[model samples]
Target chain A: MNANDPILETLNLVKEFKGFVAVNGVSLKLKRGSIHALIGPNGAGKTTVFNLLTKFLAPSSGMIFFNGVDITGERPAQTARRGIVRSFQISAVFPHMSVLENVRVALQRRLGNSYRFWQPENSLLQLNEHAMALLADVGLETFADTLTVELPYGRKRALELATTLATEPELMLLDEPTQGMGHEDVHRVTEMIRKAAVNRTILMVEHNMSVVSSIADTITVMQRGSVIAEGSYAEVSANPQVIEAYMGTTDTALQGAH
Target chain B: MRLTTYVYIALAALAVLAPLIGLYPVFVMKLLCFAIFACAFNLLLGYTGLLSFGHAAYFGAAAYTTGYLVKTLHWTPEVAILGGMALAAFSGLIVGAMAIRRQGIYFAMITLALAQMLYFVCLQLKLTGGEDGLQGVPRGNLFGMLSLSNDTTMYYFVLALFVTVFLLIRRIVHSPFGQILKAIRENEPRAVSLGYDVERYKLLAFVLSTTLAGLAGSLKTLVFGFATLSDVHWSMSGEVILMTLLGGVGTFFGPVLGAGIVVALQDNLADKVGSWVSVIIGAIFVVCVMAFRRGLVGEAQAFFGRKKKTA
Candidate 1:
């Protein structure tokens, strides 16, 4: 494919639950290696779009193309296998598993032994070094043996990122990865995301304007189930319509967000 | 060695010496059989977090199949047990495929529905002996030479399988496969997003659990010389859940201890209280749930851990 071609594309995607349209006539192109951010106000159908792209929710009509391959109608797991990995807005980790074991759960799938119950688990220690490396990347090496449920909320988010990283995806879809995290965690995670974005494409639904401005290479602003603007942070942030979408035509500029 | 290792050896010693010390061999065998049932059920409900209310279908299917094969075709005990496992696996596949489509309470409902169908078939089908149940299952020689006819001999035979399964379960729980099951149990949607075909993992867990439960049923048939309606009833399924919960739902030794207590209560109180046995069991279940939600072994471990901390 051409370098100019989008690495991922959705043509006129529409999702309706019952009679309400959640995502309507949305079309977009994600450039190769770009840190694309999908930002919108509450109820703007951002999460619904993520769900549709990952095949968690079947679209009422439209298509999803990944790396120029038609990947619509694939199973949710099939979507994941096609190198599109998404993280939940809620922190997701196996609670009872040790922090190390949580990351190993993701890494072990690549070892091609997902169904070998007869073998001793000691065999899985071979993955310990790799699992520990991922945890170390997230600064979680010290808490390796701690149960995930007992970790503080912010650390759980970091562990969630670590587990997501263990999947080694080509395209990472992060849904509000820093939604409830404190300021310090948000900056740490933002830096971690920038570090993690080295060789892969990241499409994130982020609300933090400062995060969007700092790291997002391209911003797609949605207003009530449609993309109102798409451009660099400077272009989208400066647009009056984008400003109206957020602050509702108030005298205060969109600058109020930061 | 660790303290747990010493505890295991001591427990093994007790099991080996039980019949000699006047604990009835048949009673011990019966409890062990139920222990296996509870353990198998725990693998699904406790580990996988899939509550299957219809597990009796697989257990009873194996018991009935073994009863038929041994009583009529005169199959060897080893072959007969394998036959029972195969039937259980097959039945488990059918039940699991349909049941796993719905989750949580709905999943439990569907399994219960399918199992009730199996129970009716057992009650109506002539092959299952209708109401009289599949009776006269033989305790034939284990390998065509070593007899299981004597209660002590059969006890060891059953004991060997029990110990193997206990360790096997611990291994499985620690295995990579078990980790996937735990991931699913902890967060199913997240597991799906991780590219796991969650339905397949759940189905496999269901099949493995049913087959183990089937092995226990087959042994019970051979032990008691019968596969009766009680084994096939919905109450049997509920009883297994009770055993798991009473002993501790997710703990490794919880099911074993729960099965022991439950089976002991039934054996001792059946003559004294008649049908009041169920009422007593129900009371115990409520008391256990309210008083010790962690289960006997789980609470013991927590208590022990506390004592260790103080010391």
Candidate 2:
């Protein structure tokens, strides 16, 4: 792949659920090593785009290229193995497993030892130190032995990030990483994401504007399943079309709150 | 040594001494066989979270296969059992492949439907002897050496196989592959994103459970000297589920304990209560579900676990 070529590119992606069009002919690109944010009001198809890119949902008519290779028909696990790992909008940690085990499982997948049923789990003990290191990276080292479900909400998100990072992904797709968090948690997680994006590509869907503005290198604003504005945070925040979309949604949300 | 290890040793010692203590060898052997069957079923339901309502298909299918081979072909008991196990594994592959396409209740229904179909097929087949089943199947010589016709010799053989299977399952449940199976059970989409092929893992687990259930059925045929329609019936499937649920869904020794209780209940109650045995079992099931939802061993563990925490 050429240096100037984007790491991920989508061409006229379309997704229709029976009569309703969830995502309509949206094209986008993510440059290498950049923290790109996908922001939109509710029903703007931001999540649909994320799902389409991760191969969790097939596009009705579109092409997705990762490293300039068409990956439209690949399965979710296939795309994951190709280094496109995603975190769910909900906290996706395995509740029954210990925090340490959650990360080691992902590391075990990376080592291709998932099919080794004959070997005892003690054989994977050597992975513990590395799993702990990743936990430390996400500030979850202290909770390594705790059951993941027992963790506080913010810590669970950190554990999810640690597990996702354990895959050593080339493209990390985080969906609403800071959703449903207090002010302290949002700030901590934003710092965690910034640290994690140092040498990798991150495409995140975040509703928290302060978090997005502080870390997002490029922001793409979406409205009605199409890209309404694309630029730096300041440029997109200043665009009239983006402003109108946000104002309309905010007004409707305020009315609904009544 | 761990407490469980000590418990296992004591249990083995008791099993070895049971015949000398006037305990009926054949009854004990029957209990061992059912315990193995229940353990195999638990491996899928408890650990993997795939409730297959069709386990009787593998168990009864293997019994028929082993009975036919030993009775008609005069094969050694070992060879017949292996043949039965292989056949069961193959059928498990086919059933598992189709059933895993759906999940939860749908998966259970599909398995139940497939097993019912197999039951009907067995009813019409010439080799299976239809409703009467393959009768008077010889126990035959073990490996063409030791005679398994003797009840005590057969008891030892059954006990040995049961212990081996139990240990093997324990090893599997602690293996890395088992860990992944647990992860898939806990969360499927997360497992997929972690790059583990969840379907393949589930299929392999299903096959393993089926092969072991076959092992149990083959031993039952050898011990009882018969294979019958009762073994393949849907009720047999339901019985195993009751045993697993009562013993503990995921605990290691729960199925064995559950099987023992169930077998003993049926054996003792069949003579005294006649048809009332089903009523008593239904009552116990209701009581168990209401008072001990985590199951016998599971509740015990929780009780002791809380004590330890407090201490």
Please report, as a residue range, the 10-residue window in candidate 1 chain A with the lowest summed lDDT: A249-258
lDDT string, candidate 1, A1-258, tens digits: 897788899999999998899999899899889899999899999999999999999999999999999998899988887788889998988898899999998888889898998877887899999999999999999999999999998899899889888999889999998888898999999999999898889999998899888999999999889999999998998889988888888565677343
Predicted candidate 1: interface RMSD? 0.9
Top candidate (DockQ): 1
Residues B1-311, candidate 1, lDDT per residue (tens digit)? 26777888898999999989999999999999999999999999899889999888888999999999999999999899999999999999988988887879999999999889999999999988999998778899888999999999999999999998888888888888988988898998889888999999989989999999999999999999999888889999999999999999888889999999999999999999999999999999999999999888888888888988899
Could you report the DockQ of all the candidates, in the order they appear?
A: 0.84, 0.77
Give the 10-residue window scoring lowest on summed lDDT in candidate 2 chain B: B1-10
For model 1, the stretches where C-alpha displacement exceeds 4 angstroms are A256-258, B1-3, B309-311
After TM-score superposition, the amount by which residue A10's alpha carbon in candidate 1 deviates from its true location, in angstroms, is 0.6
Which lDDT tens digits does candidate 2 get at residues A1-258? 787789999999999999999998888899999999999899899999988998889999989999998999998889999989999999998999999999999999756677777788898898999999999988888989998999999999999999999998989999999999998998899999998898899999989888888899999988888888999988887777777788754333211110
Candidate 1: CAPRI quality band: high
Give the fraction of native contacts in model 2.
0.75
lDDT of 2 by residue, B11-119 (tens): 9899999898989998899899999999999999999999999999999999999999999999999999999999999999999999986889999999999999999
